[model samples]
Target: MRAAVVTVGDELLSGDTVDTNASWLCNRLDERGVSVERITTVPDRIADIARVINEYRAEYDAVLVTGGVGPTHDDMTMDGVATAFGREVVHSEAAEEWLVEHTDYAAADLTEGTTHLPAGARMLPNPEGVAPGAALDRVYVLPGVPGEMKAMFEEVAEEFEGDHTHVEVVRTAEPESALIDRIETVREEFDVTVGSYPGDDVRLKLTAGDPETAAAAAAWLRERVDPA
Candidate 1:
């Protein structure tokens, strides 16, 4: 499955916070063989969040949104998602019950805004925090806090099917320039994507539809590129 990530927060855009959620989600998705097509960071604007959700929802199989699920005024991801899908925001009964049972917050203490969600959306349980995550029409709304996000994601991780195939090789003595042409040729030949990075020496990464294809491309590149 192909997925896109949307990280929402003024803090992220302002560089006050690093978007570790995107990288972590991508890695987990990759481990399950899912391909992450793109990741976007946006400020805590409702309209902008809706616009991005509408755009990515059409292009990717799924869109995972992190951030803005808090009780604070800037947290508008749930409402934005509802608006994007032309749905109404309502208190989720299941989510409300879950909160009452699992959290320290009483029903009166939970803000009405906190319980509001897109109509017909399923609540993704959050073990780490009081605010629950939500899923609607292939879009997932998650907490911005790293710990809460990770816990909520684990609850719904099984819902996604990833099909990514990757192979990485470290070439200690290889000159990057020497392997450029051959790498490009192999990429075209296998109809796969290849990436080269200079580290202590050189590292080549090949990604394809399946393990066989990735292994074949890696082998071909290894033969043509002189390993140092």
Candidate 2:
């Protein structure tokens, strides 16, 4: 399955907050055998959020939107999604119940704006926070906070599951440039992705559908790298 991740926050765009959500979500999605084609960091603007979500949902099997779902004024992820799909943002009973039962907040604390979800969206409970994750068709809306987002995503991980991929990393002391040709050759020969990283030790990553194919590709590239 192919997916796209959209992170929405003015802080992320201003460099005030690090966008660890995209990387974390990407890794988790990969573990479920879902390939992420794009990782977009967008502002909290409703129009932009809706536009990206609309485009990505049309292109990928699933679209994960992180950030902008909180009590703050800029928390507009839910609204953006509702507008994008031309659905009304309605009160989420599941969200309200989860919040009131677990949190110290009272009924008055749970306003429509804070607990609203896209009409007909499947609610994904937030184990760690008040703003629950929601699924509107192929679009998944998650919280901006790292802890809450991770907890919420775990609840819906199965939705994105697919055939697992086999991956291997071949480490060497040789320079990155030295391994590019061999990496490309092995990639073409085995139909796997070969990644070259420059560092104290160059790293080659091989990924394919099965273990045997990935291992064979790793071995092919490893044979050419100089030993540390």
Candidate 3:
């Protein structure tokens, strides 16, 4: 499946908070065989969030949005999603119940500050935090907290399972520039995506959707590269 990941927060944009959510989600999506088409980090503005979500939901098979659904004033993910879908933000009774049952919140006076979600949105339980995530249409609104986002996503990770990917890696003492031509040649000869990087050791990586293709490409590249 092809997907887009949206991370929402002013902190993320300003570098006050590192966007671990996007990378973490991308890695998890890759492991599940889903190709992430794009990763966006938007300020906590409702307009930006709404715009990105609307665009991505149409272009991708699935959209995973994380961040901004907190108790604070800047948290605007739920509102943005509701605006994108032309839906009204209503108090989520189910969400209140989950929080009241699992958290220290009071049932008699359950406030709907951050608990207000798009009407008819499916509440995905958050065993890690107060506000639960929501699934409106093909978009998922998850929390910004890394631990919480992780917990919420694991609950529905199966939905993203896709084509099995295969990877092969080899390193050499030679620099990346020395291998550029051969890497390009290998890519032209194979169905895999070849990548080269210069580090302590120059690293060559081959990735393909099919295992046999990846293995063959790796073997071909291996024969060309001088051993470290």
Question: Whole-model Cα lDDT per candidate?
Answer: 0.86, 0.87, 0.88
The positional error of residue 193 in candidate 3, measured at the CA in angstroms, is 1.3
What TM-score do all the candidates reach, one by one? 0.89, 0.93, 0.93
Q: Please write out the lDDT profile of model 3 over residues 44-153, one tens digit for every residue.
A: 99999999999999899999999998667888999899999999888888888888888887866654475778899999989887878999878998998899999999
Scored by lDDT, model 2 comes in at: 0.87
In order of listing, the candidates' clash counts read 6, 1, 0
Question: Looking at model 3, which ten-residue stretch has the lowest summed lDDT?
Answer: 107-116
Considering summed lDDT, which 10 consecutive residues are worst modelled in model 1?
164-173
**1-228, model 2: which lDDT tens digit per residue?**
999999999999899998999999999998989888999988988899999999999999999999999667888888899999998888888878777888988879675577788899988788887777799889999998899999888888888987789999989998877676787789789968777777888778788989999998888777888865
Against the true structure, candidate 1 reaches a TM-score of: 0.89
Ranking of models by TM-score: 3, 2, 1
Candidate 1 lDDT score at position 128: 92
Q: Write the per-residue lDDT of candidate 1 for residues 1-228, one digit (tens) a residue.
A: 899999999999889888899999999998888889999998899899999999999999999999999667898898789889999988888888999899888899898678878899998888998888899989999999999999899888899886656665636467677777787798788957877888667888787777788787778777876676
Error at 35, model 1, angstroms? 1.8
Q: What is the C-alpha RMSD of each candidate to the true structure, in Å?
A: 2.1, 1.6, 1.6
At residue 19, what lDDT does model 2 achieve?
Answer: 90
List ranges where model 1 is wrong by over 4 Å: 164-166, 188-192, 209-213, 216-220, 223-228
Superposed on all Cα atoms, model 2 deviates from the true structure by an RMSD in Å of 1.6
Predict model 3's lDDT versus the native: 0.88
